[model samples]
Target: MWVLVFFDLPTETRTERKVAARFRKNLLDDGFAMFQFSIYMRFCASRENASVHIRRTKNNLPKKGKVCVMQITDKQFGMMELFHGQKEVEPEQPSQQLELF
Candidate 1:
């Protein structure tokens, strides 16, 4: 599963870079990859991993800003590709079917 996070905050010319740096550091610490400015992407093996990242981001944010987080399954990513006219190929199924005779 992959998670996407977005956030908007008051424009602080001086602190923008600093804040962004801190945010990136925190996300990296939480095992997230930087997808874009104010956005993060993360792959988790379990829901618990996702939750931990969410909680940490929320806790580490500055006092005077707004943030939003979204979690999307691999299916959602495929849908995004479809919008761009990229069809996703499905993997082949096993040829042998198991059944009790």
Candidate 2:
């Protein structure tokens, strides 16, 4: 699963930079890659991992700043197929057994 995080915040003061740097460091530590300014992407093993990353990122941001996190599976991207012509795709069925189990 890939998680995309978009951060939108005002950088009016040095304090803002310090806060942003902390968030960036935390993201890098968690295996996130910088997709763009204030945006990051990460490959997570599970929804729980994505949630934890989002929570940590949110905690690192300034109180006034805002963050958006979106998680999508590879199947979802394949269904969109934006580069190619749009086609109807059958929804994927859930696995009968958990991978961990």
User: Whole-model Cα lDDT per candidate?
Assistant: 0.68, 0.71
**Maximum-lDDT candidate:** 2
Error of 2 at 16 (Å): 1.3
| lDDT tens digits by residue: candidate 1, 9-76 | 66667686577667768878876766557777776555886787788888888655677888777566
Name the Cα RMSD for model 2: 7.0
Cα-based lDDT at residue 39, candidate 1: 78
lDDT of 2 at 3: 81
Q: What TM-score should be assigned to candidate 1?
A: 0.66
